[model samples]
Structure formats: C-alpha cells, structure tokens
Target: MNKHFLWFFLLFCLGAAAKSLKCITCHLHTQPDRCRRGFGVCIAQKHESCMILQIFQDKALQLTYMVCQQFCRDLTFDFNNRTYVHKCCDYSYCNYDM
Candidate 1:
C-alpha cells in the first residue's frame, strides 16, 4: 500500500508540473521571418493555449501573429482572396511557426 501511494503521489506531481504553458508572443511580424514588435513570452492561463494566426494573400505569406489565447481552435478561412489560419496547441511553443 505504501509503495503504490508513493508512486501515485509522484505521478500526480509530475502531471501538475507539466500543465504550465509557455508561448511566444509577437505582434508586428516582419517579412524576413522575425518578430518586429511585442515580442516576448506569455504564461498561459487556465484553459488557454499557444496560438498562431497567419494571413496569406495570393498564396503568399502576408502576416504572422502569435500569442497565448483562451478558447482557441484550429481552423482556416478565406475572405476577399485572403486566407486566414488559426491554430492552437497545448505544448510549449508549439505554435511558434506552425
């Protein structure tokens, strides 16, 4: 009984430690593949995940946005010949460039 309890406690602690999220935050993304403004990291809150939004026009990359967002979902849409992609992830920096 003691051995089982110890293993359970250790596993629970590891799980809790893994729940924290760290994501890259960037606003003014430049064309040469760099963050020009608002570049940093954000510790995601409860129910939040790392997110990336990419906008493309004429099948070419127009802009890239990254942040930690709550209630984000993976999706894509097109408007006025522009394509918008919204992606979310739970792992650390998973949305950095994807």
Candidate 2:
C-alpha cells in the first residue's frame, strides 16, 4: 500500500542520485600525449573514481595513464629520478582533460 509505494519512491530517488562516472583508458608508448595501446572508456562503480597517472622524467612528460580506479588517491611523489602524479575525479569523463 502506501508504505510500499514510499519505499519504491525512495529507492528510485537514491538510484537517480548515485550516478556512475566514466573515465578514459590509455596504455601507450612514449609518443608525448596519446593513447596508443589500450584506448577505451570505463564506468566507475561503487567506491571508484576516475583517475589519471602521469609520469615525468627530468621535467619532461614521459607517459600518461588513465582509468577508473577503486580507492583512488591524489598525490605526487618522485622515485628513481622520475616524478609520478595521481589525480582522481568523481565526474563523468573527467580524466579526459588531464
């Protein structure tokens, strides 16, 4: 009756509010800025976000990787004379511009 209808409405509203995020995928060679190996799109699920990982060597861009990563974190660090940057976003196709 009314209780069932109320539950249904609430579930519908929650589903509408929780939208999935889309991300770009790339695994390529050192061609500067392009997706040469695995170029596609992914949909982020629960506890997942669109992520981009850029690798720099001697202040020069070496690689760019993008995907939908679970438990993603944004940070920057250096190791082996290379700099790594991780950026996470919650919007659809947000990693495309990174």
Candidate 1's TM-score: 0.78
* Model 1 stretches with alpha carbons more than 4 Å out: 1-19
Residues 1-98, model 1: lDDT tens digits: 69999999999988976777989999878576789889998989998999999999998888899999999899999999999999999888887858
> What tens-digit string does per-residue lDDT give for candidate 2 at 1-98?
69999999999987875665778888663545457888898978889999988899999989888899999999999999999999999898899887
TM-scores for the candidates: 0.78, 0.77
Task: Tell me how far the alpha carbon of residue 71 in candidate 1 is from the true structure, in angstroms, after superposition.
Answer: 0.5
Report residue 4 deviation for candidate 1 (angstroms): 24
RMSD of 1: 4.6
Each candidate: RMSD to true structure? 4.6, 4.1
Clashing residue pair totals per candidate (backbone < 3 A): 0, 0
Off by over 4 Å in 2: 1-18, 29-33
What is the model-wide C-alpha lDDT for candidate 2? 0.86
> Could you say which candidate leads in lDDT?
1
